[model samples]
Target chain A: MEDIWKGLMHAGALLFGGDPGVWEIIGLSLRVSGLAVVLATAVGVPLGYVLGSRKFRGRTFIQVIVNTGMGLPPVVAGLIVYMFLSRSGPIAAFATDVLNWWDPAAAPHDAPRLLFTVGAMLVAQVIISCPLVIGVTAAAVGSVPLEMRLQARSLGATSWHEALLTITEARRGVMAAIVAGFGGIISEVGAVMLVGGNIEHSTRVMTTAIVLETQKGNFDVALALGIILIGMAFVINNGLTALQQSGSRYER
Target chain B: MSADARAGKSEPIIVAENLTVRYRKRTVLDVERFELYEGETHAVLGPSGSGKSTLLRVLGLLEKPATGRIWIDGAQAGSADREARLMMAAVFQNPYLFKGTVAENVAYGLKLRGVSAREREDRVDAALARVGLEGTQRHSALQLSGGEAQRVALARALVLEPRILLLDEPLSYLDPLIKRKLVADFSEILTTSGVSAIYVTHDQDEAMVVADRVSIMHEGRFVRSGTVDDVMGLPTDPWVADFIGMETALDGEIVDTEEGIARIMVGGQIIYACSMFCPGQKVLVGIRPEDVMLFAAQSEVPVSSARNRLTMRVEAIEPRGALVRVALRRDGLRLASSISRASLRDLDLEPGDDVTVLFKATAVHVAAAQGVPSRL
Candidate 1:
């Protein structure tokens, strides 16, 4: 209990005391997770819309794979991204062999050695968050009644326009899905650590910094980072949750 | 010009040819041809799952027929053709309003057509007023009751002023009082707007009230299609007769013919009917309850043009709204007569009372039905 009080005090001081180190870590965490969510949403929404609204062969199989991916361990995603970004990985080999085959003078014939950079952390976080976005978005879109689309089409909406109307009807649920995706990757530590390597001044986000500070016997700073991470998650999630609740009455 | 001649002169706004829809291995609809003339209300009436709604969907271009050609305004149009689709609008059983204000919901289709905002607002207001829901533009559409929601839905379609309106049991979900009012309002709106419409319903009364012509569908096929009185008054098939509320259908054989009338043997009782069936032919005689007049048996028989009169013992006296249905039986022959409550009171009729039932020979419809039993 006393440690918790001391940790809260340290957290407040760090946030308000012009501490560049803590702010940088916090800023990096927000940037990586935010970018990851945006990228995931760009791909997930349309894919989820198709998966939710369309019927074709192998749809059930794809749905099952996506549902399984929703519960996938973040460390496994980190490991997979780490492998692809590694110097001798297939992606790097392709970049050097195929991409540079016709341009020997191309800068950085490899995949730019992104294994221990912010790019690697973003890739891993996106993998961790994408399935969540897709799964929730699919469920949300599926929950919109078929009559909505039929009525829209009967009112002169083209097939594409009808789909847009359905998506608009499901906006609240999609917003919830996006929030869930952001929440999934925001405070995550394992994937970012494996891919980002907790490099100081480069790739150290709040969660990774917390682990390093704890390992170095700097308990106060670690606890402060943990506090800040929880505060950030709580504030963001609650803000989005308020938004979701405001429009909830019209959902059904 | 006469109304008939005018109707003949106007081209059909929508035409469907060889429309067939199959689900799995079973065919749901196989309509060979259907036409909706301009400024005419054509109703497709049937019981549930009779493919009436499917036919409407195919005509509205909401569903592509398995094999068919849809012609809108004399041009062949595919189901996915947007310009053709925009020429019509539909209101379904449920309103399916989006999450927005009533104005927004009503303005959706206009916005899709890129109507100017000012024109959209004026049209939306006019449409809402037509449905008797004026001054409700800013209300949340999701907050409306079922009837109000449905009215808003109607306004949404009317705002577009489509060349054709497709209504698939739009009033089926409302309460009786609301449905009655909406039906009157809808009939007036359709008449005043002169929009060609295809209304699909299982309700015969609604079909009679709102349609210029009606097609009775059974098992995905139209068994009979004509003017409302023609189809309801003179059903040529036993199934169609029974479906159209004929209270009594008796299986009999034609025994004698004189001039335009035929004497039929119905359960050892000879009955005269105006039919073309020759002697020795099996036929079903249909009688609407309203067409039969009941008189107290003890009173002196009054002279009338009715050629068929028989004393029947009353089996039951059932009240239907303001009328009483007197179910009468004589030997193996059973019949029903509908009389006003005042007539019931004047005659003082009761169960087991003897009453004389009289009907004209022309009131009996004779259809060739080989083995149908008497239905009361």
Candidate 2:
């Protein structure tokens, strides 16, 4: 209890008293998670729309895969990304060996290494969250009535116009998908920790920094970081919730 | 030019040939040939599960037929053709309003056509007025009642000014009073706007009031297609007669024919009919209830051109809207007569009163009763 009270005081100081180290970690965490969600949304929304709206062969098979991926563990995703980006991994070896054929005179050791970098963390986070976005979005878009699409076409809408109208109708659900993707990645510590190596000033994020502080017996600092992370999630989720509710005025 | 067009008549706006639609192994629609004349409202009348809605969808370019070609204004098109679809509009059974205000819903099609904002507002207002929904542009579409939402749906399609409007039982979900009002208003709008339309419905009364031509569909094919009077007054088959409200169908053999009048024996009584059937021909005599008139049994037999009159005891009297239906029975022969409420009151008739039933020879429609058993 005493440590929790101390941690609350430290959280306030770190948030408002110009703590540069804590703020840097927070900023990196936001950047990595934000970019990862944005990338996932870009790919997931259209793919989900196609999966929801059209009936073709193998669609059910793909939907089953996406549903399975939605339950995937973030640590497993991190391990998979780690293997791919490691120095002696397939990607590194492919880049070095395959590109060497194009530039025989270039240095053979010039292959770009991605392990322990922010890019690696982003890849792991995206892998952890993208299937969630797709699964939620597919269900959301599928729930829109087929009559709405037929009505759009009856109103002389082109195929593109019909898709746009359907997406607009499912706007609330799609917003929920975006929030789910963000929540899936922002609170995830294992993936970012394993892929980013949590180096200070470069790769350290809020979750990883909290783990390091707690390991080093800095209970107050660890609790403070935890508080900040929860506060961030609360504010972002509330903002999205407000947006989702605003769209209800248009519904019955 | 076709013969009708050469004679200065309206030309066909849409023509479908060999339109067939199948679902797995069941064929839902098998329209061989259909034509919608310009500025004419054609009604497709049928019972439930008759595939009338499927026929409308195929004609509206919302569904592609398995083996067919559709030409709109002499240009071939299918469900995949955007330009062809833009030339037509549809209103379905449910309103199916988009998520927005009435103005937004009405202006949707115009917006898709890239109409300017100011023009869209003007057209939307005009269409709302046409549907008698004036000054409701800003009202939320989802907050409307069933009838209002349907009016918005109608306005949404009308604002586009499509060449043809396809209506799939648009008023089916409304209450009786609202449906009657909408039907009247819709008829007037179709007449005044001169828009070619195909209205699909199961109500024959509505079809009679609204359609310039009607096609009676059964089992995925049109069993009868002609003017409403031609189909209703002179049904060629027992199914058509039964469907068109000719409830009294008596099987009888034509005993004699002279000067287009045939005497048929039914229920140990002779019935005079205006038919071309020869003597000894088995036939079905279809009688419309509205054509039957009743008088007190003690009253003097009215001297009129009607050739059939019989004494029948009233079995039951049922009130149907503004009219009353009296069921009559005599010597095991049953018949129904639809009369005005005033007539029923004037006669002071009851369930046991014997009355004289009179109907003209022209009212008796005779069809060959080969395979169809009598429904009497």
Candidate 3:
């Protein structure tokens, strides 16, 4: 307990620019989460808008699938990605001759590949988090009033224009959905562990790093990382909620 | 008018042949034939639940008719979705302005049609000016009053430059003064622009004032349709007659019915009517309250020009704005007549004062309707 407290204090100090690696982890954590959230939002927002605005058979089934996927186990996603890239797996042969792109000095050794890299970790987290994005963004878009729809239609808006306006007007709500998704995936442990492999120098994301430290009985570092993760989750959730509430008021 | 319209110059701008709208298991509207001509105002007059709004929706293409064909400017509208969309625009009774500036709301339709930014701004400004909302372009739409919202709705529709404009009771909730002002402005502008309008309202007076042609709908069916004067002054249906402000509804047995003359007896006094009903048969007598004249110092009015002239005592004289509703009773027959306040004061009418009422036979109409209410 005492060591955990001391480590937390040290981590707090590290945040003030003492150790270079502490900054690196902070930067890497943000980069991974930021990239994952941006990609998810790019793909998810339009799809969610379509889901909310269009009418087609089996639409309810599609919504059900998205709602179910919002609660997907992140580790299960990590396992699936791992299988896709492992040596005995379908795409493993491509990575066997990885290009010596980053470091020519280690070119003779097993080459670094996108698999078990930060990119793969980010992809896994996005997979685990995008369904939540889809559900929330769809909800926000669906909440746009029928009066507006009629008004737009009466004004001669075609289907494509209507969709554009809905997305444009609902940009803030879509951002809120993305931020919530980030909160969801940043705290997720399973997929990051499976796909990133938690290598210390190359692929150690915050969640995987904390799990590795805890497993190795390094309680202080694990506790510090855990605190940081919780703090980020709290901030993202609260900020997203505030944004969504404001979005609703504007819509009304 | 376009090339198609000019080539078929004789065709009506709007024609709904045998239009019937049904929803789920209920038949909402069934109109046999309705036509709205170019550069004319046609009113669909009916009380609430009388399918006035449903007819407007069908005409505006907002609601599709279950069975009918709509022709606009000599074009088969059902076949041309784009043409139908561009040809007609509707202003709902409650003008639901979108959350935006007045200029933005007005410019929305032009923008959707890919009008240039500068042209859109100019047209929006011009449309606002036309609706008497000049210099209100930058005002917030939510801050507009009810009448102003209605004007905005009108501007929104007008800015589209549609050939046919549909309004669903567009001036329903306005004060009478505002209503009169809007009615005058709308008529004058529509006339100048040569824009045909299908205006719906429950107020028969509005219909009478504005409609070149009036259609009285009841239970989703048009009970009567004609020029406003034709429908109001010479109604073919008893309901239409009553609806057109013919307030005195009397039932009596015809006596001494013969060619060129008919006598009707009520409780005690014998009243003559100018109709073809044979003696000893009951007939419904309808006379406009305005058609009956009240007089003091009983004079023997002309005997049989209208057939039902009687001496009745003034029961009450209620002063209405610019008109007086005089209630009178003669030998158990009670009737109300709408007379000018000038005439009331000239006659010096008071309650319980004997007054002679001359009912011109030309002003009295007799008809037979099954289950006609005795009190109507």
Work out the TM-score per prediction.
0.86, 0.87, 0.71
List DockQ, one per candidate, in order.
0.63, 0.76, 0.24
> Which residue pairs clash within candidate 2?
none
Task: Give the fraction of true interface contacts kept by model 3.
Answer: 0.23
Sort by lDDT, best first: what order?
2, 1, 3
TM-score of each model's chain B: 0.77, 0.78, 0.73
Candidate 1: segments with Cα more than 4 A from true spot: A98-111, A245-252, B1-7, B247-287, B291-296, B299-354, B358-376
> What's the C-alpha lDDT at position A57 in model 3?
91
Across B22-65, the per-residue lDDT of candidate 2 in tens digits comes to 98889989999998988888899999888999999888888878
lDDT of 1 by residue, A1-252 (tens): 877788889999999997999999899999999999999999888888888888789999999999888998888899999999898898778767765777768745656586889999999999988888888889989998877888999998987887788778888778888988898898788899999999999999998898898999888899999988888988998888898778666544
CAPRI-style class, candidate 2: medium
Candidate 1 accuracy as TM-score: 0.86
- Which scores greater on TM-score, model 2 or model 3? 2
For model 3, what is the alpha-carbon lDDT of residue B158?
96
Each model's RMSD to truth, in Å? 4.9, 4.9, 8.3
TM-score of chain B of 2: 0.78
Q: Which 10-residue window of candidate 1 chain B scores lowest in summed lDDT?
A: B367-376
Give TM-score values for chain A, per-prediction.
0.92, 0.96, 0.81
lDDT scores in order? 0.87, 0.88, 0.75
